[model samples]
Target: MARQTASQSTLNTDPVEQSPAESQTSQEAKKAPAKKPAAKAPAKRAASKTSSKTAAKPAAKAPAKPAAKAPQMKDEAAKADAVSTAAPAPKPAAEKKSLARRKRPRKAPATGPVTIGRSGFTKLKNISEIRHYLRTSDTPVFFVGATAFNLLGLDRWVRGFSYISYYDSWDGTHPRVFCPKDKPYVEFESGEQINNWLLRNHEVRAHIERRTPPGKRPQVVMVFFDEETERICEELDYELILPSHALRERLDSKIVTTQIADSVGVPSVPNVLTTVKDWDELVKVTNKAKLGQDLVIQTAYGDSGKTTYFVTSEAEFAAIADEVVGVEIKVMKRINNRPIAIEAVNTRHGTVVGPCMTEITGHADLTPYRGGWAGNEMFPTVLDDESRHAAVQLVRKLGDRLGKEGYRGFFEVDVLLDTDTGDVYLGELNPRVSGASAITNVTAGAYADVPLFAFHLLEYSGIDFEIDVDEINARWEELASEDEWSHMVIKHTTNSVERIDAAPRTGRYVLDHFGNLVYSHGDLDWHLLTNESEAFFLRIYPEGEYRWKGADLGILVTKAHLENSHGGLTLHAKYLIDAIRGMYRTTLIEGDEPQPKPAPAKGK
Candidate 1:
């Protein structure tokens, strides 16, 4: 039987209170005869400082109160009781009648019509105002994607937030997860297609219609979306909260990213951008930039690790002739560098940055492709003070530049740190929600303020608000060293297709005395994960599903580092990886077997 980890009430805990000014306005709005407040409104506004408090301190247990205060505490308590027990003098008959009249019950106030965004409202001035606005909002918001890996746990920050996914990672238990029942075994080529499929599903359409009221369009967000996604959203009367696909496509190119960085005074690795049809031209271009023969060549689009090629000789160049010949590509000199990734949001006020994390790539035990992104590790020592500060500046400059180009919302950038010189250079750009967001939202800074993605949602929320980007960035930088977190994306590392007869369930697990993984219990997410010994595993392809090379098997998250200083998997990480892989029972498919096909097209 599927177990429910967190109930709706527990997961929807509100961590906001109105500012003094707003509180006064709200109090007046309640008592006004034109718009009376609900009878239960006062209870809904009760204070719960569970997440809002001083966050500069480390995440250790709170310090115990001093013993000397015990007697004073008792005397204070006694005086409070004495004052409460004291009786009041009798009132005159006229005054008593007036008091009775004021205490009579009144009818509840009627709700006003829903407004998109925060139209016609005062601009927000600080984090407290921003938090209170989002907490009380009723606009329907949906995250549509292949999986909820990117923006999971964001529902805690925003009201009326939920997810619509193609993969059922929650095993039909999570209250907020909605997966269509008409799933057919189609080999999806990209995440965009998966999102398009979900948008067109009949069950998904009905679900959205049920929650959405008349004359209101639901707000939709996704990690990977294209023109087709925009068109489908238009047909369904839903709002796609992102920049145009054309702008994103242009900025997605590595060459374009390099040029933009250059224009904005951000440095990139020494390289030249040109069309190289042969080895001779490539050598000429590299020599022009004073780059050595050992080079990294990347095409205009696609991630560098997946599409980038290393060339030191003519033979190496010939290996990727089809992809490189006559196409615009970036050829850079190889350097001893450490890759770092950081996420930021370009808001109307300015750019707000998140923590810097080291990227984990190309571990043989984790992934099949070379230099493929396996996971990310975020700790205090991930970067020195100088390098970390430089990365934040680079991201801020890039975000400001993108804002000028009419692009805004969430984006991730790759920053290359030269281990030899301690200099930081800008890398590629991801103009949407990224895989690293899973760790970004759970950091100490996020708990103190709001998750980075909340700002992205605010951009599309249609509310007029303002924030001090510099203040937020400074506070986050100081709190960076107060938390430690890491996650590894376990993929099918073999070159064959197999059927999973037995697979581990998605939930919490603990290691026993022998360092073996043991199931502890089910969980809603990694937010409540406590120690290094406990891990939360989210399964992608569950039991009885087909697994292929390079396919994601699952994700393992804990409160410790998974990679060492030498950029390799730690011993404990290996143990967990091996144990999880050991539980999978799969059988290879014989040759000449046809692959699974999609269900018949509707009306065909």
Candidate 2:
């Protein structure tokens, strides 16, 4: 079939399919070309103008029939708009699903009409079967790909069903999936021309597009990423799942997950993985194996503890032992730590757990990689009770052995318990989404319906999934010991400065001019601000204006995400100086106005 319509017109880009459920499918309507509507050329006959009463003024028209109808005018105007993007008024079916738990009964609440993010939070009813999960693969595309996930409203689950990305862009408008504005605009200017325009645009691929069962066509196209993804799938073909390349090749030897945590008995950091390549045979193997008593070397790819060194003298190993050559360091013993963190889910129906976080790494060096993220606190006594039952049986036995090795999605493991031998080691394994998944997607067990990412997208979404992970961990440990709510990831201490520049006129009430609404996070997630149009900016903080060294200053959901002073790294640097001293300073209102928008935590 003409090589399958030139391989479905170069579906966005391709290449990367190791099977994993054929990557999910939807090659965007053959690279979105449907434009041919403005071609009526030959009408330029104004070459020789005329005046003489307009060339003897054409013989007066409207001369018969309609003479008396000229007085009929009933207009009645009612249309005003400067920039209207309305689409948030549906979602009533008993709050959209799970009046508590229905194996099958919801028929409302999806407000199916309005939308946003991965299509209105995946249609409510237990994520509305991911809107009928591709009715059995491919051809359900709707990705306009502009971003801001329609400002995080997720376009009512992406206009419910059907999506493929770049619907038609450069604002010319044709986006059933949204791509307007010169379609891919030079394929986004760089990253090698967006990987050569998604492998020369095989019609924006999801295996050449077809929609589903009716005729059959989804070969595959799943893409889930976070962090570097090597120039966005260099030269593209598709098939990507990057939990930082399996955390840099199976946690790139955290002494091989500490020898897979001593062959799955998990408990670490009293380590030693020496390899004296130089630095004078690593200083005689740290003085004949006494191994720097209270040390920590770890080079081969370090994060949050910066190439993990800490010699403690020899002038800190002579100003850092020639930067540990032949890398492979691992020399631990630096205890007195307590992170915890958790969010597993590797299912075919099994590894589904959530409540256990405890990070807040004191922003290691103020921010960015050096900032061991100083904010996280999911109660439940951080860990103890046999180290939270041996760290939830070591991440449900490492997510049931990564779902028998096929590896499912949404990962997060981090251990380290030892508050006096409550010994539970396994420190890291974020397959993805582990900055503590917004503490399990806005908890209260996702407003009482249970959405720790809808059980990690219903584990591979072939459904049939069951729950009762010890009855949702004893109903989220009896509703987190009766509502405690806590979250904090405040990284942005100064990027783009604005602790209070001045401005807040539009409907005026974000406080400051003595009012108090000086919080942040767009218009309203907590206080509900939307007058001039709410989104001042602060939920996950991704709009702009940032600084204070650089990187991360967005998470701060509260309620005791961590108690006791000095715990989650100086309480996230004193919770960013109590959210920059609760922003507050309004009543100025000038040209680009903007200011008054802080209000986090919440009011009863």
Candidate 3:
């Protein structure tokens, strides 16, 4: 799921007494109602302070109840109880049935739209209204994930926004980020595992329960989740605001994506889906499709370059036979292509597409695998005008089809540009917010209107909205042509199990005249980065963590293109990688080292 950020002052100005359930009525109120005098301001201040403290404190800290703040706590508790039992309001029958089917527990049904501030009941008709609603919303939204990189800048746009992250990128200094301090040694095999572990942690749960307002369920979003995540969210009553895990899993499969694309008239690379038990069967399938001797085979699921296989000779197939044999694989003719990633949202209005970016993949200096996704670059001319239009159209079609298939919210598609034929082929679908979102949310379109993910929120926000999808797309295309942005995910590449004694801080770093990278300043997000000389680095494996082979070290964001037109690392990109790597210092764990030989010295 994609999260959004709004300004804090607007959000903290006045509390909306309306619940999400109460925001459905379309009635207009009578005019000439004089505004009442403002209520005591101290109470509001106290509540804000309490909420901020709870949100900023480390999860491991014991819940504090200072005597000086006791009265404020009591006031908050009273307000919560009052809101919960206020009334049993009426709601639209259809909306009632929908909420009931969702199995969400609420105190009452809403009869009419509650007035917000002194604005009375007004419908959200434009992007500006939507932005105002989000900024002023007091809803507690928790984006739980491995790290907060994908949705890092969201808090800036939404009040009461916070990130529950497993990786403490800010070392607990970030006011909106909360990472638990007591993590035990556990081998995490996937992003889901990390999220589940964080969800189950006592401190994390306490943090969520503490900041959530009374009579309101907290909203949770993540890039990777499963049924276990759903159950955990249910146990805590945190609204998992994304498509069902089962639906996402089904759509996540490469085979399923191909079928959906085909159904919507979106072209994928010439391919055949079949179970390959041996090299002979693979050959037969490829030959029947006329895919020739060289082919690319992919399993239903995997990340980066792990599950994708490329083969030409029997020897090459033999090495990965164990993985492909008896498994359903997508076999395609290998093409000389440039990989592109585009993010889109399935909104009630329609599907909204983000900028198309050139994918930086498999650079040995950045990643260990041949086809691994290391980063992405977003700039004008990534594709010609015609090709860009085609790619956007294809993504919109896929997103619309996904909505028809009972899936909604944020999704990313990998499209391959056939250099020979100028064709755009759907490569795969990531049915969730991905690493590419860092650039997607901060593009020229986002500044002019809103990020693609905000539309995802509107779909779930239960508020009616209208947009000219074509106009937005055309304007975004023009703005994207003038915008330049790039980001790289740096991973620990050495085959060693070492503990990080010191790691680079998560903030802006500038390249000095001597080419040395130095800390520029502390910042919460990279939107403040003004030039290529300065980059915002979000650290993943902080000090005291084990840095193993292929472990993510951090992420680097800049305005410069990291890869050239030929798909090789630019010289400046290489320099940035070396300088960033030089910031980390690690020492081998004691148990992993050889024992000393004292006996030989004594005998001599």
TM-score (all chains, Cα) for each model: 0.78, 0.26, 0.80
Greater-TM-score candidate between 1 and 3: 3
lDDT of 2: 0.38
Lowest summed lDDT window (length 10), candidate 1: 73-82
- Cα lDDT, all candidates: 0.65, 0.38, 0.66
lDDT of 3 at 402: 93
- Native-to-model Cα distance after best TM-score fit, residue 317 in candidate 1, in Å: 1.7
Candidate 2, after superposition: displacement of residue 211 in Å?
A: 5.1
Question: For residues 178-269, could you state the per-residue lDDT of candidate 3 as single tens digits?
Answer: 77766544434334556767887777777776777666677888766666677667756678999997787678777888998998799998
Instruction: Sort the candidates on lDDT, descending order.
Output: 3, 1, 2
Most accurate candidate by TM-score: 3
Per-residue C-alpha lDDT of model 1 across residues 139-216, encoded as one tens digit per residue: 778898656666777878877677886667766766666777655444333445567678877777777776665546
Judge candidate 3 against the unseen true structure and give its global Cα lDDT, from 0 to 1. Answer: 0.66
